[model samples]
Target: MRKSRKLAVLTGVGLAPCLVLGLSTTPASAHGWVTNPASRQAQCATGTVQCGDIKWEPQSVEGPKGLKDCAGGNARFADLRDDSKGWKVTNVGSSTTFNWKLTVQHATSTWQYFVGSTKVAEFNDGGARPAPNVSHNVNFKGITGKQKVLAVWNIADTANAFYACIDVNIGG
Candidate 1:
């Protein structure tokens, strides 16, 4: 897997090369979470929902890709998988916008949105990288009622990905 880091400054002349090498050091920490629809992490971060450590680092709900769990299969943030957390549900129409708040942007493979087992929408980042905030217009395809919109951000250079579950009430 490829890694990268940004260095702010070098104090000594001899540290120039070291500082340059640091540039290739993939960030030790990468973080992001869905905010538009207020994912579990978002609710935790905002104190709208009480949670564990995840409340301190909402953007860090990351784990191996391919898992459908709201916590991305990570045990620490598994509270996200609980449906009784009182997460705020955004009332969305047949189509609505989903926004992601990124604290540490990483090279991405794709962004997928799923309703139940069916893929409702997707945006391919193609590993082109990502902005501080990523937004996608998702089409619910007539799926209605209270449902969990699982959003996955697949990373290009790693075996892991970030996960966010937005509780949504679909209707008008």
Candidate 2:
């Protein structure tokens, strides 16, 4: 019985390292999100807005291409689709600067911003890997009033895209 107990203890000790190795300690990439105008996810990450699990990893909102929804077609982030959530609006001129903070850099195809179905601004990356930080001057010259801007980051080498919905009060 003592020998059997010793063997069991040794076996448990041998498997301890394997159990630890199987655990993932790497931080979630937590990727990228818009900060300047305060995307829904950004607001959550920064504690300006209260939300669900998205608040913990705002930069990770990703889905397939061609989704026009505010939540980037991610049901886990569906709160972003609520227009009455009282997301603070950033007042801006015809042109405003938007910034993206990328915790995980990826090759980018293009960056596009939209209001409803109308594409207001687009920036092409020419299939190059994006910098850790990206910013763009978005022109909405002819558009005015409070609007929900849908920002999309199209990945160059993948079919996935990240999304951000920014609430803005634009003045002509």
Candidate 3:
């Protein structure tokens, strides 16, 4: 009985490291989002507007690239697609700066801004990591009036991108 007990303890100790290694923490998944000009998620995060789960995780509007939806097609944040939600419209001139608040900076490929199907501006980062706080000054050339601007942050290392939509009243 003593021999059997000793063997069992030895075996458990030997496997401990393997178990710990397997259970080692993985990298966090939380990514980035836009803040200034109050994207829907940003509005929720700041309590400027009421929202659902996105309110607690404004920086998580991630999904596959090449999507045009405001929520990045994330069903959990579908509330953002509701245009009648009375989203606060930011009054801006013909040109304004858009700021990005990255929760976790990733290697970026490009930053794109779209007003409807027309791309107003694009900045190529060439697979470079951006700072946590980034900003882009965009000119609304040939664009005006109330518009929903879709901002996409393409990650160079992943098949994903972070999305944001800022409602604005331009040249108002």
lDDT tens digits, residues 31-78, model 1?
A: 899998888898998899989988888888888988888988889988
Winner by TM-score: 3
Query: What value of lDDT does candidate 2 attain over all alpha carbons?
Result: 0.89
Q: In order, what lDDT does every prediction score?
A: 0.87, 0.89, 0.91
- lDDT: the better of candidates 1 and 2: 2
Q: Supply the global lDDT for candidate 3.
A: 0.91
User: Candidate 2 at residue 148, lDDT?
Assistant: 91
TM-score for every candidate vs. truth? 0.82, 0.83, 0.86
Tens digit of lDDT per residue, candidate 2, span 24-67? Answer: 56655767899888899988888888888789878988989888
Q: After superposition, how far is residue 168 of candidate 3 from its true place, in Å?
A: 0.3
Clashes of each: 2, 0, 0
- In order of lDDT, best first, we have 3, 2, 1
Q: Give lDDT for model 1.
A: 0.87
Give the least accurate 10-residue stretch of model 3, judged by summed lDDT: 25-34
Clashing pairs in 2: none
Clashes of 1: 2
lDDT of 3 by residue, 72-118 (tens): 99999998898998899999999999999887889999999999999
